[model samples]
Target: MPIVSLPVIWIIFIDIIAWTFFHLFISAICMRLPLAFFLKDRLLFQVFSWEKSGELWQRLFRVKTWKGFLIDGTIFLKKGYSKKGLHGTRLNDLKIFAAETKRAELTHWLSILPAPLFFLWNPLWAGWVMILYAFLFNLPIIIVQRYNRGRIAAITA
Candidate 1:
């Protein structure tokens, strides 16, 4: 049950504002974290055996066909690393790319964690919509990051 009642328009407005804060705040925190934190592959960032080094995403999602259309969110931040494309063709550049993918993945994952907060003010169905919105907005990006990181691991191997 909602802790507070709000008109639908007010809820919509609040959702927009809240999501904006969540995205930027989470991104800023991730960005400020030491780069070393992302350099090593963490458990969550690992491409498990089932992923077949990211080919699963290629087969299931055809990521190549649509990934180009997704925005490079770093463009919005003042001092963020760009993940729009590879920085260069060197081994070091590729390693950096892989690390940045981990950072990106973590940011999206953290962004999804606050979905339940909407339940504090939303009706049952609307609260579920917020959860849906979280996944819908963030999951594809997370998939792309994982896919690219797996591909990078294959290349660097």
Candidate 2:
């Protein structure tokens, strides 16, 4: 039920290009937001009692087994805290790392918000695919951020 149409190949190309742009655009904007906005645990980032300091993700997704394999977005942006690994063991460093996780999580979540816009030009199935792509591209990063933040909480608590 798209309002416009394009060939399958064009759709694929656009999907790739558009998603890349969306990710970078979102990250760029998020990086400019005040650090204080990400310092607090609120909304989607709050760790619940059941999470057990992110061990939930380890049990459910074996996050540790694959998390290291995921690309660090900081590599693409060339600015921002690196989530590739913890940079320091000091308390202040850990706190900053935890805050950056919140920022990273929000960025990925925001990146997914534009998936519906793909529907304007793609076929119904392709639009659904775009939504799927959006989640696939961003969700793992969100999961990592949440897990890392939870671990940091365990450390700081």
Candidate 3:
């Protein structure tokens, strides 16, 4: 590559590294943070809090506005979907589409990574790394949701 190209390559490399680190750091934070205090343990929050759910509903379904935004932001950023408005009508369809799309994307991304990197890099050690990252990151949130649900059920009963 030309000297001029070197800078561009360096920039791309830096960006990728930054992106990877950001994902890992955010995943760590999400996994570690407590969620029970915030969402009140609703079933919606519990089921959709993880990466798989987010990918399933948000990215693939391309659900309008809130659904898409929330799913993408949370899975990729370690946050939650908006609970503001009514989640009516096409909610189920949107979720299915998102899930399908997420699966495809995950497969594509995983396939592209170097297999040897799985052994060399802790983060990229295997495809399951992503799932582990998601599970741990979403655990705190799930716990919070479970607490909330118990409170709601008790109140209702």
Candidate 4:
């Protein structure tokens, strides 16, 4: 019997389902509770903080204008997507962005799964490819939320 190979694209497709499943699951929980309990509070959130000046790594992600085009998560993000159009003068808008950023960060953590889970089905290439696909899909939204929140935080300060 010949061993059939699974394509990387298939791994990516599974990545989408895993990503969205966890996305919806976590989002629903967050909607119901203010738990705000990330698995590792400081380690996960702070590691991705990039920088205030942002030259080292944050520069790699899209600018505000360019980012709006990617998925326009400003519109699609569940909680505060609606708040984007609100004036910065509104302190509540800052709160909304903060809440939404926490939700988006939850998805980033969710993206880290599936790779390990995929190892059960595909121990070699598929597992690694799924990991890459997960990061590629999730990181930008993470960056966008972080960047936008930093700006919003400044305004509300």
Question: Highest TM-score, which number?
Answer: 1
Off by over 4 Å in 4: 1-19, 35-50, 53-58, 72-84
- Estimate the Cα RMSD of every predicted model relative to the unseen true structure: 1.0, 1.2, 14.7, 5.0
- Any runs in candidate 3 off by more than 4 Å, and if so which? 1-6, 41-157
Local error of candidate 2 at 77, Å? Answer: 1.3
Please name the candidate that would achieve the greatest lDDT relative to the true structure. 1
* Candidate 3 local lDDT, residue 93: 35
Rank the candidate models, highest TM-score first: 1, 2, 4, 3
What TM-score would each prediction reach against the true structure?
0.96, 0.94, 0.27, 0.65
Alpha-carbon runs more than 4 Å astray in model 2: none
lDDT of 3 by residue, 1-157 (tens): 1122234456446445744765555444443444433224333434433434334333543333433233333465444443223244364533433333333233223333332332233323333553455454444333333333333333333
Q: Tens digit of lDDT per residue, candidate 2, span 25-48?
A: 999999999888877767777887
Q: What is the TM-score (0 to 1) of candidate 1?
A: 0.96
Pairs with backbone N, CA or C atoms under 3 Å apart (clashes), candidate 1: none
- Candidates in order have lDDT scores of 0.91, 0.88, 0.38, 0.57
Query: How do the candidates rank by lDDT, highest first?
Result: 1, 2, 4, 3
lDDT per residue as tens, model 1, 1-157: 9999989899889989999999999999999988888888689888888888889999999999989999988888867788888999799999999989999999999999999999998899999999999999999999999889889888998
